[model samples]
Target: MRCHKLVAYSVSAAAMVTLVAAGDAWEIKSQNKLVKHCANREGYDVCNIVLDISDTHALCSVCRLNRTIPDLAKPENRLRWSKLEQAKRRLLIGLMDLHLPLEAPVRGYSRGLCFDFLEDQRSNSDVAQKFITTGHRDGVITINILEADDVQRVWQREHVGERYRTLLGHMRHEVGHYYFELIVSDREGFGQIFGDVDTAYEKALKNYYARGPLPGWEQSHISAYASAHPAEDWAECFAHYLHMADTLETATAHRLIEQFSEQGDFEQLLLLWDRFSASLNEVNRSLGLSDAYPFVITPIVKNKLRFIHSAIARYVGLQL
Candidate 1:
């Protein structure tokens, strides 16, 4: 887990139950017997229920990944942590759906996905630690507790000129680094698909950060940071694929579009996404907001995404 660092939900504000639609063909259990509003996105295969009960913690068997819980010293912090957990679980559900291997020492041998919801002095004056970077290292993903705070997240968003940002996006992007290790670093046949990952990662990263994104970078990358390196490119692409697939399935499940079952299989899913994202963009426009999905999925990128889908299908024992 240390060797690689490529790493790379929803439900509602209050009501305990709601339904999720996965195209027209699939309907996953949205709520557990406890009536916790839930939906399987990426990591649900391993944990029947991704979120913990109101008072307990649940271990993720597939990833064997749980570290520290956020200190809920402040009354509101607990609620924030719970919301963060929900987002984390939803993200893991998507990773599981992809069938990408996990690499955590806790889970032993290629099974690794872990989290630590940590706090700092900013969030809790009593805490000795002053700052915590949200990053992944040695089989663990550590998120600063402040990220769960609305004020902090919004501040960071505006500082970055990003069209979209969220706790789930951070989780997904970091996990993208993790999966890069799993699929590209150590796996064979990856070079054939993703190009050689041997390009100096550290050097590329420095240049990306120093000069900012390439001029007119939209022609090349989905986000400014994506131009950092090939590894980053892969991670960004991985995250985008998950974003696209998850939203499409949810939209389909909600009857926002044609039923997925009637539409057909994975190919149909792609078609649906193409149609749905346009409306999603326009809806955001009407609200004077950035497009929900701003990046264009180029033909080359589409083929790369298909490779990811094929990998997931193989993991699930489906004939791709």
Candidate 2:
């Protein structure tokens, strides 16, 4: 995951027209014999399956959120964009399953979302003259195209000392920041639960990089990066909450576990997650890969996740 520095800016009103037109191209259509079947590319068939089932002439809802895709004139950019879209669809599907809102800012919803898949000089110097960092601002999330490359992502993981990192993880983490603005920033007692987000962000970030996390930071923070700022702590915890929710949902869908209700008791969800994550790790080991989830959830972290669940339940009108 890249460093997230919140920038204050609203979506341009003028862009709404173009975004709406793009979204309309993906509307579900009745299957008909006249419809031309789309071909799946490189075994990445989520978008193709969506088109096939719906008989739509455009990409899926998740793919339609792409306001800006990387330049496809470059051969490698197409594959990278494809990989990014796959991870993005997974995130969107999970959000939908959880009954969270999926409106785009262009759709007249204040909390609407969009994506900008960009590349920096590191990936294509001829096309990108400036650096591109992954972050979320207003309603738009930006992801660096290099993250889609397995070799580049692995190098970043080692350089950052992260036990696990993936393009999906990046999306989940950045969206956490966006939701904090929508769900928590204005709520009463927000500071009390997640600390003060109104603190000087740039200075805090500078200091965090200068001296690193405080001693025994893991006792309270979910990750070393989370200790950098209160906002980061909330985002990291929120990301972890999504990790658990989506993975549990996938496991249930695959019948690896009996059907379980996410809207049920929060404690029960955590218990199931404890068992499921352990099994997931064992499965990864059997395949000679690292643990699927590499961080321990201390008691404090659990409390943070519960807070997230409560917030999400509130947003979705659930009793959990």
Q: What does candidate 1's lDDT look like per residue over 207-293, in tens digits?
A: 876788868657656777777776676677778878876786567668898675321366676778788899999998999997888
Clashes of each: 26, 0
What lDDT tens digits, residue by residue, belong to model 2 across residues 1-320? Answer: 15442111111111111111123233222222122123432134424333333444445445567789888788888789888877886787677767766674422246578999988788887864588889988778999999999998999989877777899989999988877765652455667666788889999999988898867978888888888888888888888988888888878878998866767779989999999999989999999998999889989888888888888777768423
What is the C-alpha local distance difference test score of each model? 0.63, 0.73
Task: Give me the runs in candidate 1 sitting further than 4 Å from their true place.
Answer: 1-64, 99-111, 125-130, 184-195, 259-267, 287-289, 318-320
Cα TM-score of candidate 2:
0.81
CA error at residue 154 for candidate 2, angstroms: 1.2
Clash tally for model 2: 0
